[model samples]
Target chain A: MEQLLQQLVNGITVGSVYALVALGYTMVYGILRLINFAHGEMFMLGSYFALTLIVSTRVGVLQLVPNVLLGLLLVFLFSMGLVSTVGVVVERVAYRPLRRSTRLAPIVSALGASLFIQNAVMLTYGTQYQVFPEGLLPTTVWRVFGVEVTLMRVIVLAISLGLMAALYAFVQKTPLGTAIRATALDHDAARLMGIDVDRIILTVFLIGPALGAAGGIMVGLYYRQINFTMGWTYGLKAFTAAIMGGIGNIPGAMVGGLLLGILETLGAGYISTGWKDAFAFVILIAILILRPTGLLGERVAEKT
Target chain B: MSRSRGIALFLLAIMIVGVGGCAQPKAEEKKPAAPAEPIKIGVQGPISGQWAFEGEGIARAVNLVAEQVNEKGGVLGRKIQVIQGDDKSDPKESALVAQKMVAEKVIAVVGSYASSLTEPASAIYDEAGIVHITPSSTATKLTTKGYKRFFRTCFLDDRQGLFAAEYFSKKGYKNLAVIHDNTTYAKGLAEWTKKYLEERGVKVVFFDAITPGEKDFTPTLTKVKAANPDAIYFTGYFPEGGLLCKQAKELKIQALFSGGNAVNNPEFVKIAGLDAAKGAIVTTEPLPGDLPYPEAKQFMEDYKKKYGDYPKSIWVILAADAMRLIVTAMEKTGSAEPAKIAEYLHTQVKDFPGISGPIIGFDEKGDRLGTIHKAYVVDDRGEFVPAP
Candidate 1:
């Protein structure tokens, strides 16, 4: 039972990152209806950027703060903001050109962009895996029901959940988010209503990529390591989560990410961990077979 | 009806045919006349991607050896030329590279760092009648596959696992938790150590195999801490192993963590941070810095001079030695032919002074007759200090 609880904690922490990153996938799909395959590389670049900044600047200023929490907050904000800017630029250059081309064009362009970014990083930073600087996250353990919950788990869970809530509020409350939803539902109608669909699409890319960047930074901090190839498996899993949660459904992405994470963790503990990856995809298959639209997902008429 | 013109035309045609025949023989004669053509050797490995640095290290060492041999007035009065190809660490790609090397008619082929890439690729080289040697492939199945043409310079995972287990027992650690990457190398080492440690009454408290390339390992660390093991044994490559060490530290697991040669990479220390990597132990094939042999020191100097970076793995030295072994066997047999070289290798390598250790194999199975593990600890500065 303790093992079960620990696994649950593990699942939630990782699943939260997946949910956040998957949210980006869902949002981009929701608005532009493009897969944005380069989204994973965007996340990778975010981690790299955060790693460079935190290690070079904030980590050296340790004498200023007797407490470590303040140092971490600064690192998170600086990294997140930088990654958000990167997201906007990538969308403008890579996706904007293919917006009017054939459907296959954007898909191919996204893949090319993904490869280009991954290889560029590989060449510049080298193929060596890098670890994040230590002591930025807390390590204290709290015992609950004979299971130990470390501070890293708590932080990852809180940040992920916190980000999800913020996103929810933004989508439901903010004028910009309303424009995004309106454009997503009916781009032509939204444009006729002076919604500026292109601006909304750009905003979606910005938000989605920023979330992906946050997830990437969180992963590097949580795992304490980053590499050029680190984005592939996580990216694939997040994509699966987005689809399992009904591709374009925001809340569905959240549920799918958490469920996939929990299922994967439990499967690792109870069944063979060797098959854990297989288990993540099994949920995707099951979700596709059952409701098809996923929990909270509503099927909409196809646009001609 | 112009008989004189017909006779002149026939004589001209005969003259043209005679010149063409003379030119063809001239080409064939040049081949035999230049019997001093350099003895061609092929080197293959991942010169790109994640393992590119290691591959380039091997290539540099091989070129250094070639330069040394050529300076000494060539091998058997013939210069040695090294041809290189990149495998990119993919099995199918490795096999294709091996085929290309074989087509190039290289006397011996050296390379491929990983076991997964080497196993399939070695079979291709063996089938193509090329003598293939690996610098650092540690899979148990590689030598066991009965590929007479395939050989490796490093000890396999079982030997590495036993060395770690023995060190743990010697250090008086009773409770142990092992986490493996579920790869052929990692899983094999972990299983071997588990069996060996349990036999000696060391409590095997936790055993888990994690997926490779995953970013989060909080769940695994949580399990390891809950089990309260004395030490954490990880048998995986640097990429994941480094992260595991950092995560373990972040979780305050505080147990001794050790891994196999895969974690010997300095990148592990850099990635895990010096604090997280401190006190971590890893068993690796001997690095150049750890070499006590005079020949090894010379080889190290040559490698550093040529590559301008410290040799990445002891495998690079082995790769150089494999080239030496092939050349030595060729010299011993006094022939450049593959059949003669293989026959001579079985007899000549008994006392061959390899850079890693003495290259003494009893049979073709490739167990180095006098090689043992060199345990290393990651210091606070991230340098692998040889564990006394």
Candidate 2:
């Protein structure tokens, strides 16, 4: 029972990051109707950016920083800000130009962008796995409800859930959120309704990557290591979560990500860890066969 | 019209004959005046991926040996030219690289570091009638495939596994949990280790396989925790190895953590953090620093000077030794031909001293005659020091 509880904590902590990255995939799919395959690279770049800021500041300007927590926050904000710009630039350069072309064009462009970013980082930072600086975060393990949990795990879970909630409120309460929802409903109709559809699309891109970057930072802190190719694994999982939750559904992505994470953890814990990845795909296939629209996805009439 | 066409054909033949006559003397003149064409030695490995550091170490060591040979007025009056083929650590890529090396007309190839990469690439080399030497690939099946040309400097999986099992059992860590990445090398090592451990009357409390490149191992570690073992043995590369150590420590698992040679790297310590990595044991060949050989000490210093870091792992020494062995075979045979060099290596080389250790040439199955492994523990200084 304790082991089950421990696995649950592990699952939720990992699930939150997947949920964060899934938001990026679902949001972009919602607004642009493009998969934005390069969104994962933005997450990778965020971690690298955070690594650079933290390492440089710790070495050069440690005295100016009041505490490690404040320094971490500053690095997090800077990395997210930088990755948001990267997301917008990727959209403008890779996707915007092919907006009216064949649907294949933008998807292919997204893939090309992903490869370009991966190679660029490889050429610049090298291909070796880099160790994220340790001791920045507390390493204490807490006994919570008869389960052992590290401070980092608790922090990752709390921050990720908190960010998701904040994003939910922003999308539901703000005028920009309404514009985003309207665009997702019908792009042409949203444009006719005097919404800056392009601007709204760009805003979604910005928000999604920012959230993804936050996930990246959390992963780096949690794992204490990062590699260029890490984006592929996490991205694939997040993309799967989005598809499983309903590709363009916001709240559904959150539910899907957490469910996938918990299922994978439990599968690894109980069944066979070798087939942990296989479980995620099996669930995806079962969900697709059972309900093509996903569990939380609403059936919509196709406009031919 | 027929007379004119005959005259044009005769004129073209005369022009071709004139060009051939001029090229013959020029080629002859260039051959004698210039040094013998450099022998092309191919180096294939993952130059860009998770294993890039190991590949770089191999490449650098090969280059270092070549530089030393060339500086001493070349090998057999011909400079050694190292042709690099970056396999990117994939089996398909490894085969492509092997084909490229064959096309490049290399007499002998140095690497394809990981066992999964080497197994396929070695097939290509064997079919192409080229000698292939691996510095780090340790899968037992690599030699058993009847590939006469394939040779490796590292110990086989069985040997490493037996050594680890003996060491742990003698240390009284009877209940153990074994984990692997499910790759050719990792699974082979894990299986052999488990078999030997069971034979020694040690109880394997838990055994599992994890996917490579999966960053998180908490779920699996948590399961292992429930098994309540005295030690956890992970047979995989350093990336996951380090993460497992860190996560296992976080779970407050009191079991000692140990792994195979793949975890014998500085990156493991770096990723696992200093505190978490301490006392983490790895079974591998002794590093150059740990070896008492004077040549090993020199190699370490020269390597640091050249690469700005100590060798990433003992694999670098193995890589350098592979190059030296090939060169020695070439020199002894007085031929750079692949078959002749292989024959000389098999028949004549005996207990050849190398920076890594004394290599006893090849057995009938083309495996190294004898190989040994040493255990190292992560010290408080974040270095892999010889375990007491």
Candidate 3:
């Protein structure tokens, strides 16, 4: 029972990050019906961007940080802002031209963009994995009923939930949200209704990657290690999470990410750690077989 | 009529191959004669990619040895000429590097560092009857392929596993939890270590592998924590090993954390942080940073003087050890022919001293003989201090 509880804690922590990254893939799929394959790399960019800000060679950025909490908040917002800008440029240069082409073209473009970004980071930063600077967040751990709870775990969970809540509110409660949803439902109809479909899609590309970047920074802080090629694995898991949760459903991605994390962690803890990924995929296959559309169904646009 | 046409086409294809074979020059084998041109020694390793520093290290080390040998006196009345073959630390590229070395007719070749990269290159060199000595690749299966000319100055992974098992027992640790990353090298080491421990009647309470590229091992460590072993031995590369150490400390696991040679890296301490890394014991063959013999001090100074920096890691000096063996064999045989050099070293060489240690030599399996494994504990200063 203690073991189960411990793994649940571990799973939920990992799942939160997966959920954040999964949102990018889900939202992009929701609107454009295009899987943003480059979404994972944006998570990597977020970590690297934050790292550069914290420790630039020309000047020690740590000395510039005024206080721990404010410094971390600033780092998170600043890096996510930078990554979102990069995301917009990527959509403008790479995906925008292929928007009218066959669906396969944009996916291939996203993949190419992923490769280009991954390699560019490798060339710029070199291949050595960098450690996240310490003292940004409290590293204290407390034991409750044989389960270790680190302070950072609570903070990460809070940040992810906060972002998700804000995003959910923005999408469901605002006129801009309805306009975005309308554009997702039918591009021609939305254009006729003066929705500015191009701007809406651009907004999605911006929002999705920024969320992924935030996930990246969160993961880097919690894990305390970041590397250039981390995206391939993190991206794979996030894509799996998005699909499992019903690819185009926003809320489904959230539940799926957390669920997949818990399941895989329990699977590794109980069944066999070596076959953890195999176990996760096997469960995914079972879920998909039972529900072809996904857990919640791929809800592209809800009929108002 | 169609069958006859098919037969005619097949006959033509054979005739074309026969013509092509006839047009090519026959593969040449050197006969021992009066030396004229410089002796060609090939250096094969990653000149690019993630482990490029290791490849570059092998080159610098080999060249330094060659310079030392030539300064004393040219081998077999011929100056040693070093030819580099960049494998790019890739198995596909490793084959091309081997082919290039064979084409250059190098008397012996050193390197293609990682086990995956070296295995392919070793096959090519074996076929060409050119001696290839890897400096640091430790996969147990590499030497079992029955290649006459393939040798390694480094001990096999099983040897490392044995050294680790003995250490655990000597330290009075009976129950152990062993973790691996499921990589070929790590898994092999873990299995062998488990076997050795079981032979000593030590209970392996938990045995499993963690997924690579994972940032968290809390669940896996939690499971191991439940098992409540005397110590936890992680048989993986430093990246995951370092994280496991950090997380294990966070969980406040009472068991000591230990690992084999792959975790014996400065980067291990850097990743784990000084507080978490302290007291972690690592089994490693002597690194350039921890050279056991007096000659190593001079080697370091000379290397720094020539290269403008100390070697990238332990691999540089290990490559130098391989180069010195080849040179010694050539000097003893009084011949630059590869066959003679390989034969003399296999039969006659014993207790050869290397810069890395007091004595370095190979057994029948082309594995380095004698137990050279040193256990080092990460001290508070973040340096790997030799554990007494």
| Candidates, ranked, lDDT | 2, 3, 1
The 10 consecutive residues of candidate 1 chain A with the worst lDDT sum are: A59-68
- Write model 3 residue lDDT over B282-311, tens digit each, in one string: 988766767757778889989999989887
For all candidates, the clash counts are: 1, 0, 0
Q: Against the hidden reference, what TM-scores do the models get?
A: 0.76, 0.79, 0.85
Global local distance difference test of model 3: 0.85
Greater DockQ among 2 and 3 belongs to 2
Tell me, by TM-score, which candidate is best.
3
Tens digit of per-residue lDDT, candidate 2, span B132-172: 99998876788889977788888778888898999999999
Residue A132 displacement (Å), model 1? 2.8
Better of 1 and 3 by TM-score: 3
lDDT scores in order = 0.79, 0.86, 0.85
The better candidate by lDDT, 1 or 3, is 3
> Residue B217, candidate 2: how far off, in angstroms?
1.3
| Candidate 1: Cα lDDT at B177 | 92
Q: State the lDDT of candidate 3 residue by residue for A1-304, as single tens digits.
A: 9888989999999999999999999999888888889999999999999888766621224446656667777788889999999999999988999978998999999999999999999999998888876555667999999889999889889999999999999999999888888876788899999888888988898899889999998888887788999988999999999999999888989998998899899899999888888999999999999997789975333443
For candidate 2, lDDT tens digit of each residue in A166-261? 989989999989889998888889999999988997898889999999999989888978999988989999999888999888898899899899
Clashing pairs in 3: none
